[model samples]
Target: MKTAKIHLILSCLFIFSILSCNQKKEQKIETTSISQPEMVLDLLDLQANNKLGKDTLVTIVNDPVYHKAKKYKAVSASLLVKTEIELNKIDSKNTKIVFECVDGYKPEMPLELFLNANPFLAFEDVDAPKGSKWEPILKEGNEMNAEPFYIVYPSISEKDSRYKWPYNLVKIYLEPLNKSTLELYPLKNKKLETGYTLFKNQCLTCHSINGIGGTMGPELNYPKSVTEYWKENELVNYIVNPASFRNKVKMPTLGITKQQSQEIVDYLKYMSENKKKI
Candidate 1:
């Protein structure tokens, strides 16, 4: 009888071990599935069966990013927003469209700009040479793929002063602007405040000051900016002509006057003084 009991006990232990292993395997599979979600481009098409999928495609001609005027097949952002507004009866009076990228770069612009900008969601590149040297590969250390969705404005040049093109484009948020913050307009100097306005028009779209602007570029003031590292004179020169100083500075010259450049520098200094160290 004791020998029989020992055999039964061993069999029970073996079954318990197998059950535990199976549970762990199931849990791992579940976690892996939820980690990387597939990105989707929404256009608010109520009639379309696919809603905001790749079904609704538009054509973009003469794309300047590639050489030789390549053609791109994309989705018209203007059409999507218009349709959504009409279909769902959305109030676009004080609307602000936020373009969100996969790299956490969000730039919110007015709804009028969204309509006038003529932005599109480019997916497949047509008329592109396979062996061409101008293929859209990774530029910086960014690993995010610009495939499936790339925000492109055909009319605007890549070298334009207001060139705020975002690649690896993911989602779009439409909301109303109803809040005022210290960083929104920053502390303005009564006499030299044109620098502040210039900074808002040019730099504020990309670079953030005291955690209150776009997320694509680096933060300027919190922990100490380029001003703290580089000398004042050198920083001024770099701002005026970026490529002359460094081979390929991402920032482009805005053609601001010497007085304006100094104003922007002074504004940076002002932020640094008021910056709360992070």
Candidate 2:
């Protein structure tokens, strides 16, 4: 009887240990599933100045290379920023505004373009065209329900690299343009100069040049630029499709063309060769 009793107690203890392990495993999965933080754009702060108009009927033109266009009743990005700036007591003369998406796509729109370009932020679709590709192209995964923040630049060409239409946007920040840092353009090549502009539009928000831009990304040209490390062809492929090289890369595709990628790469090479100019 004593032996039987001891065996029964041991079996119960073993079962308990197994259950405890399973429970811990479940908790571990749950903890890892949190993903990223919910992006918050304080509408209250933006509305304080009352410059942001109501949601007006606006159309969002999808990049023609990918999908057809979609329309939405959206808010004015310009007015929203105008109001926000006024409420926050910020001077727009010297500060640059940045829009950041969840997928590491951040673009710093020139204040002139931010005001004059007349971009809109579409929160809701107007009406889907029957059998259209609009809704089908909305981002998948964590951005599945990204609403109230689809960027639209109606004034610019669809092919323009000045800015990209980014959804799942999370934050907007202000930084100094630092024209003095960017004014030094020693290279006489017009193509590389245009490429530099493209880099400023698409990359300056994350990657710093000569230690003048943002720090979210690596320094493009200081002691050593990307040209020294990443091969030219590989760099081109990486820019066009980052996921092809690394499955878990944080950098999102900025929608640059093949030619544009080449130009940007050449510009980076120039910067690498002439680091003092930057």
Candidate 3:
């Protein structure tokens, strides 16, 4: 009788232990379920201000905070903005812009935070000029605002040697032609053909007018087809620093000084005028 009673006691203890273990497991699962909702909400909040979806998964992984939380460095992250546009192409009509984040970061942060509190909608009035030149209706009026604009997050990598932290942000503005502008070009009144020779010597190697030069870069004969988006100054700036516009571009600096660049521009203008005749 004592042996049977001891067996019953053992069975009861075993059942009790199993029940206790199951209860603990249920409690743990419930806690995890409750916390998961909060985590989802946090992720959604992080993605709120992303209008153009520029951020990437790689960017988030490289973040110091994320590395510390996950207890290890991330291998890679997905790129958010696959397509990129030149800075000059961004204007009032198409103000919403997306820049590919650095190689290993993710798009979990709000765009406003990434862009330093500048909204995309604010670009319309920020880059435009104040006064009208040659009547707003007759000429293409100032449509963009004058405020300095920048990429929300530019792509950066450890291998990059050119730009340091906080890449140089490009600013654009409009200026009207005045007496000073007219006076700067005294040679224009004297010899019209001087510009053409300079172009043939300097730019004829890579660039072609009406399908002439090597097919390395885009054809310059049709500036409208190449890019009607960029302003005059923007074009000049690109000619000055091709590296600033593209990452690791093959185009060399060409050592063309400012005066030479202007001469080339004049030659291009002459060519453009002649293109209408062709």
TM-score of 1: 0.61
Show model 1 residue runs off by greater than 4 Å.
1-50, 53-57, 82-91, 102-108, 116-118, 129-146, 153-165, 175-182, 276-278
- TM-score for model 2? 0.51
Q: Which residue pairs collide, candidate 2?
A: none
TM-scores of the models, in the given order? 0.61, 0.51, 0.29
- How well does model 2 score by local distance difference test? 0.66
Residue 265's lDDT in candidate 3: 68
Which window of 10 residues has the lowest lDDT sum in candidate 2? 32-41
Comparison by lDDT, 1 against 3, better one: 1
Residue 196's lDDT within candidate 3 is 57
- The segments of candidate 3 whose C-alpha lies over 4 angstroms from its true place after superposition are 1-192, 223-229, 276-278
lDDT of each: 0.62, 0.66, 0.37
By lDDT rank, best first, the candidates go: 2, 1, 3
lDDT of 2 by residue, 134-157 (tens): 343443233243443677776777
Best by TM-score: 1
State in Å the error of residue 187, model 2: 12
